[model samples]
Target: MGIDPKTIDWDSLGFNLIETRSMYKATCKKDDSWSPGELIPFGNIELSPAAGVLNYGQGVFEGMKAYRTLKNRIVLFRPEMNAKRISMSTKRLCIPEMDEELFLKAAIEIVKDNVDYIPPYGKGSLYLRPVVWGTGPVLGVKPADEYTFIIFASPVGPYFKGNIKPLHLKVTHNFHRAAPKGIGNAKAIGNYSASLYPSSLAKKTGFDEVIYLNAGNEQLIEEVGSANMFIVKDNVLKTPRLAGSILPGVTRDSVLTLAKEKLDIEVQETDVLLDEVCSADEVFCTGTAVVVTPVGKITSEDGEHSINDGKIGIITHELRSLLLGIQREECEDTLNWLHPID
Candidate 1:
């Protein structure tokens, strides 16, 4: 179905997929050389049942967005950072890395082609999902001889939906999102698979998301199901250090930088204990999808502990506003994070 932005109610949109006009695709051969990718119509392609991505889960992906500014310009936030991160993920997965320039080129082309699908400035934004997978059929466990890279976009509303109410999270001790020194830092497909059950359990128990802890001790706070966690105490912002098991999210980094530079807040990347979180003055999470969301309560075996009196902290509100302002071009782009889609 063709997407008509005029007919669609942008305000009612959700974080769901509505395939757009076209996507960009490229393939790599057995000799580890990549072909110049092309923009093609959106559809499924044939793949062998024994494809490496199916059998061995050899794949990596990235999530980003293009926003419509108040001035009617489309811009991407830190596309180069996504390019570099995806390249690193591909390398870790034994897939040939596409050059950063090529990655950006493909992203630009895909967003520009679907420009009309991008919602108006305040309504929503165009979300882009770029994926690379091993496509070659192989019986043995190894990297595929062939690989495919593709990027598709969908217009999505705010991930949390409705009013920006603070969320409630559960600290899950039964499951770990990633192990120590594993592929946790990479945006690999397998990492998310491990989080499904725990996250579902949290939801079933009436929690918004699951907060994962370090695998070994289950004492140190790692991250949430789909975002990075942060805590505030004594006027300082703290998040878990990137210890190879945590995904270094672009939005996480942006928040840290903004807190330090713009807000003049002291930011620390260190081991955040569960006890600290329980007693924190404020808590929040950041990601490409959710942006910045405040955590009002954390429920664990000990019981529920309300953060900042179960209200959004002043810093959380200000940081979210600043980030959104910069994204919509309502504030100065002093960080040079936005890449125009024109």
Candidate 2:
């Protein structure tokens, strides 16, 4: 069971972990299939001192959220996409791939068991984190003999500290996000670990996040920290193509689709140059956590450039409003994106 709802101050909730009542867990051994997972009390589990995830950093994770919608129902936004992405991530990390059905099942189980922790209809959402780890002990630099999968839930408000104020981003010429043929496209835990240093340095300089450039091409942009980058110019929306370094974000895909089908905007996935972004009409980043955050200002080696006069642009606002409307079931599910849980 979860804590009393009266104990929670939903208005002041931030993007921090507040443990829920239950979680999902399953394990798989090398050369075997995954076990049928079950809902268990939410708590930390012991791991081997020489676990493969500890030594070699063999792990991957997925982020998702369940919303209490205006329709008085609990729902998830495009969870199937998350299932497919996590499957790809597991294969890249050499962990046993979980069946897509099992992945969806575990996600639902954890969220349902912790239903009480879900915030009220307009407050926030229950953020779900599904992680797969190389749990078995390993001596050499190789895949683990066993793997573990877990799903947990927490109620979170906004990803940004001050809410959705347009982000202040800086381009880092000193550090690149990932190599051309590396696991940059995968949701591996190691990939995020590599970003911590650069991102922290940017934050220390009064920026919200760092815009990573493609390691292979210095003039090209890769992503905004962990989110995908997009720039709008002359009424056309352009983002970096799905090269070897950029992670294909679910929110990015949705925005692209909605922009083309709904807004009638021309969408381009090409090599977006740094110079092009600095002069674009609007800039934004998208991800599961950020949803669609407009970029107010972009700072580079040259100087600071204000996007849309340090305000959210028309396209960005429409896309975010459309995205949230669908998530909250306030508008028609035109693309069948929402998955109802109740």
Structure candidate 2, residue pairs in collision: none
lDDT of each: 0.91, 0.91
What is the Å distance of residue 182 in model 2 from its true position? Answer: 0.4
TM-score of each: 0.97, 0.97
Per-residue lDDT for 106-193 in model 2, tens only?
8888878888889988788999999999999999999999999999888998665455799899999999888998999989999999
TM-score of 2: 0.97
Q: Per-residue lDDT of 109-167 in model 1, one digit per residue for the tens?
A: 99999898898888889999999999999999999899999999999987766578899
Clashing pairs in 1: none
